[model samples]
Target chain A: MFEGREPIYQQIAEAIRGEILSGALNEGDQVMSTTQYASTYRINPATAAKAFAALESEGILRKQRGMGTFVSDGAPEQLRSSRRQSFFAERVDPLLRDADVLGIGADDLARYLLTSASDASSATNTDQNNA
Target chain B: MKANGTATIQGYGVQISDLAVRYGSTTALEGVNLDLAPGRIHGLLGRNGTGKTTLLSVLASLRQPHTGSVLVEGQAPFEHEVLMENICLIRESGDVIGDVSAADALDFVEVARPSFDREYADRLAHSFGLDLSVKPAAMSRGQRSALGATIGLASRAELTMFDEVHLGMDAPTRQKFYDELIADFAEHPRTFIISSHLISEIEPLVETVTILKNGTLLLSEEADDLRRRGVTLTGPTALVDQAAAAQTVLGHTVVGSRDLGPTRQLTLYGDLDQRSLDEAERAGLQVGPVPLQDLFIHLTDA
Candidate 1:
C-alpha cells in the first residue's frame, strides 16, 4: 500500500490524510496504533511512530495519555479547508500547464471542463433518480 | 499475551572504534568505527568477502578484533557474562543442536538464554512449517534456516544479530520470518543487526543502514536519508545531462531513443533539492526514487 518515492512516514501521513478527507476516518475515531501499523505493513515501528508524530503535530491526530491515538476533532473539516486552499495551485495550475504545452487555449480548457462537469453531475443525478 | 516484563531491558547500543580483524596474511576488516543506537533494526549490507561477516563476528564476540575496542551497552562483551548473555548472533549455518530434535534444541536454548520465550518459539516453528520432532540433521536446508530464525526470535536478546539467516528459506518462509520478526519486535523492542544480501526485501524493515566495502565502513546512516540521497532522473538526454551536471551522477542509460528522441535515465547520488525537483518536473522529466538495492549496487560497485 505504501509503494512511493517519498519516505514511508510521509506516505503514511498522506494516507491518513486521504482517509480523513474521504470521510473513511471520521473525527474522534481511534486510529491503529503504531505497533499495529508496524506489524501489518512490515515497517519499522519507529517509522510508523514518526508518521503519527507528524500527524499529531499537524493537529490531524491527537494522542490521549495512554489510551492510544485518535483523529482530532474537526480534522476532516480542517483538512478539507486546507486542501481547498491549495486546490488551485496544486491541481489547476498543473492542468493549465499541461494545456499550455498542448497549445490549447483557456477557452477550450474551460469548455472541456464544463462538459466533463455536466457529465459528472448528470451521472450522479441518474443514480439519485434510480434510487 | 501478558507483557514479558523484559520490555524494561531496552536494547543495547554498540560502539566500535578503530576495529580491525586479520587472519594471518589477510586483513578481514580495517579501521571500522560505528555506533549502533539502541532498539532499532540496522541493515548491514555488503558484497561477498567485504568483511560483513567479520564485523558481525567481532560484534558477537565470536572473534576478538585484532585492534581497537568494542562496547555493548557501555561495557565490553568479551568474557562479560551479563553482556554476552544479552547478545545473540544467529548465522545461516544454523548453529543449533543438529543431533537432537527441534523441540529438544529449543528446550536447550530456553535453558541457555535467560530471555528465551518457549511459547513464542513453538508458535514460530509452527508458522514456519517446521516439524519439531525432526532433528536438524534430518531436516531440509530451508527447515534448518527456519529453526535458526526461530531460535533467534525466541531468544529475545537485547542485541540480536542475524547473519544472513534467510539463506536457505524459500520465498514464502522468508516472508513468514520477516513478518514474525516485525510482530515480535513490536511487542518487545530491541536492537537488531541483520546482515543480508536481500537488500530490497529488508529495506522497509530497517531504519538504519550500514554498508561495508573492501573491509572498510563505507556509509552508515538512516535508511530514509540514504533513500533520499539517491534520485533517478529520466528525460530528454540534453535536459537530463544539463540537470545532472552539478550532481554526483552514479550511472546512466539511454533507452528507446529511436521513437522518443534521445531519452536518457541518469541515476544521481546526492540530495536533489525541492526546487530542482520541481524544475525537473516542469521540464517533463520523470524523477523516481532509487531503490535501496540499486543504491547498494551503485555504492559498492567495484
Candidate 2:
C-alpha cells in the first residue's frame, strides 16, 4: 500500500522485496496475480504488473507459461546475501567507525553488543512464550 | 487517433532539467527536474499558490522555464512545434472568446489541434446535453467546465493536462469526469498530468504523484508505494515512540479524552514490523494508514 512518493516502479520493487523477506511468500509461492493485486490495492493493473515484472527481472520471481509468478528457489538466499552486503556497507561498518571515533575499546563494544543481543533474545522469547 | 492529416497521439517521456522560473518576486518554480514517463497519468500536487500552474505552463510550452528546458521526446518543447501541438493544457477557467459559441470554440479547437476529432467532440457535446449555440460567457460555471472537459477529451493530445478544470463542479460531475477520463485513457492511451488540490478525490486517477512545496519538488512517488510507506499511529507517547523508533515520522499530534494527552496521531514513514504493528495496537493506539491529503499537509505545512 504505497502512496505517491518515490517512483512507483521502485515502490513496487520494494513491496515484492518485503513479501519475500517476511517468509510469508516462500520459495515457489505463487505471487499474487497482478490484476488481483491491482484491484485489491486499488492501483492500476499496469503498475502492479510493473512490480511483478521488476521482480522477475531481478530473478526473485519467475513466471510460468500459463500459470502466474512463483518465487524463485534461490530468491531467499540471493536476497539475504545482497541485504547482508548492504547491511555491512550501510550500517555495520559505519557503526564500527563511529565506535572507534568515540574511543570505545573492542572489548567494551563486544560487551555492549552481547548484553543488547541477550536482552533482545530474552524479550523475544518472553513474547513468544506469552503468545 | 488522427483527427486530421496529423496524428494526435504521440507518446514521449518528459525530462525537465534544472527548470527555474520566477514571476516578479514570486519564485514559481526553481531548479526542478522530473523524468515523467510516457502514457501514465501523473498527478502534480501542491497547495494553493505553490506554482503548480507555472510548472504546467512550462511543460505545455505556453511559457518557457527561465533557466532550464522542458523536453518532449528529448527536444525542447518550446522549440518543437509538433511536440507542442501534442499537448493540451486545460486550465481551470478554460477562457475562450466570450463572443464565440461553444460550437465555434469546439470547431476552432478541431482545427487548431491536429488530433481534435470533430465527430468525437460533437458526440460528447450531445451526450452532455451541451447546446452548441451557447457562448461560454453566457453559460454556468458547470457548463464552462463541461466545455473544458469536452475540449480535453476531444483534443486527444499525447500529453493532456488538466489543472483544476472541475473545481466548482458538483460531486456527480466530478465523479463523471473521473470515470470518463479513465475510460478514455483505456481506449486512447496518452500521458495525462492532473494538477489538483483535491488529493483524496483524485488519488485513484493518479498512477504517480509529484508533490511541490514552495516551488520545490518534495516527493515524487507512486501512489501504491506512498500508501505502503506511511502509517498513522496513536497511543501513549512512550508506546508510540517505541513503535515508531527508527522510522521517519511525517507528523504527529495529540488526541485523547483531555484533548491534551500523549501523542495520539503519529504519521510514520517506512514499514513497521509485525511486532511493532502489534505493539502499537496493543498500546491502545488505532494504527491505520494516513491518506495522501493528510500526508501532503504534514509535509508541506510550516
Instruction: Give the CA lDDT, 0 to 100, for residue B168 in model 2.
Output: 66
| Most DockQ-accurate candidate | 1
Candidate 1: which stretches are off by over 4 Å?
A101-103, A118-131, B1-7, B246-260
- Residue-level lDDT for A111 in candidate 1: 94
lDDT over C-alpha atoms for residue B164 of model 2: 89
Candidate 2 residue lDDT tens string, B1-302: 34543564435678988889998887899978888888888899888888899998888877878797778767888867787778888888565666789989988887888888788888877766678899988887777877788899888898898998886677877776776676667557788898888888787678888988888888887776666666766666776667666353433232112223755456665554545565555445557766877767777877
Candidate 2 CAPRI level: incorrect
| Interface RMSD against the true structure, candidate 2 | 9.2
Task: Find the candidate with the highest lDDT and give its number.
Answer: 1
Work out the TM-score per prediction: 0.91, 0.66
Tens digits of per-residue lDDT for model 1, B41-158? 9999999999988988888889999999999999988888878878999998577889989899999999888889999899989988889999999998889999999999999999
Instruction: Mark the 10 consecutive residues where model 2 chain A has the least summed lDDT.
Output: A1-10
Q: After superposition, how far is residue A60 of candidate 1 from its true place, in Å?
A: 0.1
